[model samples]
Target: MRYEATRSRVEDYFDRTATKTWERLTSDAPVSKIRETVRQGRDQMRERLLARLPSDLTGRRILDAGCGTGMVTEIMAARGAEVVAVDISPQLVEIARSRLTPGLAARVTFHAGDMLSADLGRFDHVLAMDSLIYYHAHDIRNALSVLGERTQENIVFTVAPRTPLLMMMWNAGKLFPRADRSPTMIPHAPKSLSRELEDIGTLADLGRVSKGFYISQALEFRV
Candidate 1:
């Protein structure tokens, strides 16, 4: 599928499955072992992301790109950071807004739009967790360039690793599509992301989080 078509499909899928996705990300409600394992992995990723941030985020500005259901947004707000949370799926954005208390909501400004194209102004940091796996290589570069421009300190994002085993699993998923039709996974290499940061005159700090049934890589760009 073309990039635009894939993007559209992803948006539609997320919009329709927003509730289920939220549960999968942040719920301990009874589930199969595989589903529980995936949740544990996601929790590890969240912990790693939080650990990489500054020790004190008080009064700092943050951009929570692809802030589905505001999991990271809520945590940042609790730390006294001002957050601008944006998501492409309006349904997910709505759920995020609903989850926030009035005080926490006051600390966040939500935008329902594409992170690459949004003029959300600059921030001390940008967090794009588990979101870039949907983009093609060129678009990933573009998104990183935009993020580099809008971040004053660092930009952190996760991508599915383009390893042989993971790639094979991704291909196999295409044979038996999910009923809700999840987006096609576009795995990325750490080297390609590093090169993109170099092209934009930034530094890349890469790290891996391997837990449960998932292994994701995070890239932090410093300008």
Candidate 2:
């Protein structure tokens, strides 16, 4: 039930509390220095994740799990990949749809629902950037197991790497009022995460990115 609980918190946070804030952060709009770091870190992480995939994605079917604003989805679609982009927040999905590139619209489908839904069908690859960061290791493993069951080639995702700085931030974030705080990020040691995922796939620590307040580690699961 941890997954469901965390998922609900995430849905609420993005759909209601921070919708506009995220919309701005993911855009070129000017933001505070703290938020700018997050924006930059996310941009770098996205490129790193995309670089792991084939450059020529023609005929590939990809699932952009937690596809916020469709940045990754759009890029993949532009490269000839048919991307099924799913986000927990309906508002975000709508924004993604509205901002989709003209011709690339046909290459992507926007869905506001669980990314793990089998109804969305199988995929050749799955990209879940910063999506699994809120869940505990067990839940992360379970989520990966579900996605892996249908994915053919690779599952690339990210986690908040356990570190002194991130730990301090995690502790400090708890001081915020319940109504204003984002869902708590549960950091994971790469080795521990890998052990939990061993039965699910061959896990690899692709790398980590840290910029000011934002920190995330890219991981690949070969199925």
- Score each candidate by Cα lDDT: 0.79, 0.92
Q: Write the per-residue lDDT of candidate 2 for residues 22-102, one digit (tens) a residue.
A: 899988999999999999999999999999899999999999999988889889999999999999999999999998998
- Least well predicted 10-residue stretch by lDDT in candidate 1: 19-28
Backbone clashes under 3 angstroms, per model: 0, 0
In model 2, which runs have C-alpha deviations exceeding 4 angstroms?
175-177
Question: Estimated TM-score per prediction?
Answer: 0.88, 0.96
Clashing pairs in 1: none
State residue 58's C-alpha deviation in candidate 2, in Å. 0.8
On the 0 to 100 scale, the lDDT of residue 96 in model 2 is 92
Model 1 residue 142 lDDT score = 72
**Model 1 vs truth, CA RMSD:** 2.4
Q: Quote the lDDT for 195 in model 1.
A: 73
Q: TM-score of the candidate numbered 1?
A: 0.88
